[model samples]
Target: MGEVRLYMFQTGTLKCKYHDIYLNQGEGRDWEIPVPFYVVDHPRGLIVIDGGTPVECATDPHGHWGATADFFVPVLDEKDGCVAQMQAAGLDTSRVTHVVLSHLHLDHVGAVGRFPGARHVVQRTEMDYARSPDWFQVGAYIQSDINRAGVDWFFLEDSWGDFYDLLGDGTITLIRSPGHTVGHQSILVKTAHQNVLLAVDAADTLDHWEEKALPGALHSAVDAVRSVRKLRAVQENTGALVVAGHDPEQWAAMKRAPAYY
Candidate 1:
């Protein structure tokens, strides 16, 4: 097996209402959370996980994020662009061969169009739902950000099993843990030493993982709960480090780009 190197970074912070993140608690309080993304180096190629916030969000949040920007505003600049971050870290952004999205949310799928010819992977369920999401979810999946006409798309299905070895090297694996969206998923990376699980929106914040608190917006609360529980069991069994999707506290303490897990 090839050695794997994982890099974690944040594009910026999103200002969202507390109630919107942690179920029914902190209804009126606004909070800022990190928009974290990961890049991994494997013998196969460079793979980017959840393409940080789109570069456009840095320039004009409203233009790219639409009305949703009113509620969940991104505080960013051009420096936070996926390419810029990689370049700064001495990584060749142009060498990125694949981009795996945890889900189709605008924030996670922002890099879909950035890497030309790079294979973009997402759950088949997510691709289908993105075609015509419930009226309430349209803003979360911005058409401008996801309308990548020329990029290669590799849609995955959960029918295959619980974990899909993305490269057949067992270095990067995808876990289908829907809840935040119809087909949301998380990533599990096995390095030489330990396992690291990026519990994307499935566990948006540590609060969700620790207390089983429901995230505010959901297609199905039942599914959300089940996904979190599944993630918990996976963590317990694998002894993997569970990184919350947008945890403010966790993001601050963790190392950013130029650092690897």
Candidate 2:
């Protein structure tokens, strides 16, 4: 039973339509969901999972995102950003050891370039798809962020299993639960007292996880559904408290950074 420390950050709040997250639900209404990123303080390394929207989006969402800004507008305070949040909480950014992106989505990969010294990790399939996404997915990847120069990356092409034990310590496990994107993944973080699952976009909210709604975005709907079930099994097996990607209610209840979990 190896354990580590987990710290969560609310980089900003994303404003989008209800349909943007769930399938055929909450149309015509606007939704404000939290954009959260995480940092794990482990004996082996300081790991980061899923950086939020680009910090530049705080000042100029339009200029930073271009036309895609029309669909997803993020509202963030000047102090909002993964790097800024860590600094504010008294954590050293230079100590960031490994940055693992859940996928190369606009929101998820925004901070990759900020951690040049850290080893960035992602699935090979995700990297490939992000390079030349279909028309539907083109707007999701901001090439400048994911394809940033001088950033060291380590791709995992695990063919035999879903779980990759990062650091070989069993404290942080990367789970391949794709569907929201072709290579989207989730994370399983074990702290001293609990197993916390960062179900990044695999199950965007409680609605998706409960099958009350499906994700509006998908590379494969079939795989999306399967991945939700797979996450459920992980939750059951580890007794993990599952934290969905951008659920407003869940985010509200969570203890933000400076309060480790």
Candidate 3:
């Protein structure tokens, strides 16, 4: 079996609904959420999870994100992108063989075009949901990110279990945990010492996961709870370290890119 080293990168940050919003109903505070993308140095090839906010979003946030841009306001810089971050970490962008997205939301797929050589993976149901999203969810789905030409896409349409082993080695697995989005998923990486669950939007913060609370942003509350529970079970069963998608606390404690897990 191949050992894996996972590195975390900060692509950007998002100012979004505060924790109180999900816990209560008052005019909640604003939370600054860190937007992270992970690079897995797998024995077979380099793999990246979730592209962060594009550099272009910094110049024209409204144009790229529309109305919701004000809600989860992105803080991006020119050098904040998948390729740029990888390059900064001393990795060759051209060597990225797989790019797996937990979902197709703008923030999660913004820099998808950066990895030209990688097969961009997503759930088929997510693509379909993005194409014909409900009125309320329209602001989160950007067509440009999904319809780019020349970008290779590998859709996970069918799987035997709750997850699909991307490389068939059990080293990396994509688990179906729909909640934040209809087809939202999470990544499970088996390292030498422990299992790491990249619970993307399935659980935005550790607080949400620990409390079994739903975030302000979600497609289905019922499904969202179910998804978080699944992740919790995985963590409990495997004694894995669960990584939240935008948890400031967790991000603060993490070792930045170049220093890996």
Candidate 4:
């Protein structure tokens, strides 16, 4: 195994409603947040966690996202797509071997087409939800893109907990953590210095984890709370650096152009 380093690809940022009660007391406020996609350096190749919004959707007036678009809008120019961000970091998108998605939310899976050659990994339950969604309950942002890409797919059928070695080298693991969605998960990158847990939408912001707050709207509020507690235990047990799904503070603290370890 080689030393693992993390790079934040700021495809864009958006002004979203602050969902943490401590921050807003049940009231919503506009806040700037990073639509961050992460890249991990592994011994075998680079891996990207959650592709941010695609550049084309930015101007699609009748896009599927609807009003939520205004909340998690992409502020980056078309030229600043994930591919461009990867190039800026001295890494090519084509070199990425795998792309792991936490869920199929439009904001999370928007750039699925960017890495056509890479295998796309998603939970089996999430795929089922995407294929036959209760349109009234869920949003379908990547359904068309997923159908068009014809990308290779790897589905996780069994429960994933403890640890998972993606490359069979004990370097990269996807720690199963459900609740925000049926198959929501967090990525654990074991680096030489310390382990990093990319807690996707399991916790949308740092406050969600720090305050143990749940997402305002969830399929299951109780389950969401349980997931948050589970993640907290994982963070405490491993002593890993935890990164939230869309924390504005994380984006502000990160170096935009070059990659950071």
Please identify model 1 stretches exceeding 4 Å from their true place: none
lDDT tens per residue, model 3, 193-242: 67889998888888778864668787888888988889888889888889
Give the CA lDDT, 0 to 100, for residue 171 in model 3. Answer: 82
lDDT (0 to 1) per candidate: 0.86, 0.87, 0.83, 0.71
lDDT of 2 at 237: 94
TM-score of model 3 vs. true structure: 0.93
Model 2, 103-137: lDDT tens per residue? 99888876697875899989989999999988877
Q: After superposition, how far is residue 88 of candidate 3 from its true place, in Å?
A: 0.6
Estimated TM-score for each candidate: 0.96, 0.96, 0.93, 0.87
Q: Could you arrange the candidates by lDDT from highest to lowest?
A: 2, 1, 3, 4
Q: How many residue pairs collide in each prediction? A: 0, 0, 0, 0
lDDT of 4 by residue, 1-261 (tens): 457777777767665566531333446765566788888877677788876776666567237466656555556677667777787779866678998887877667755757767888888877787777676545544566556557888988755544567888666777666767767778877777777778887888787787646665355666667777888887788898888887777757765557466
Error of 1 at 16 (Å): 1.3
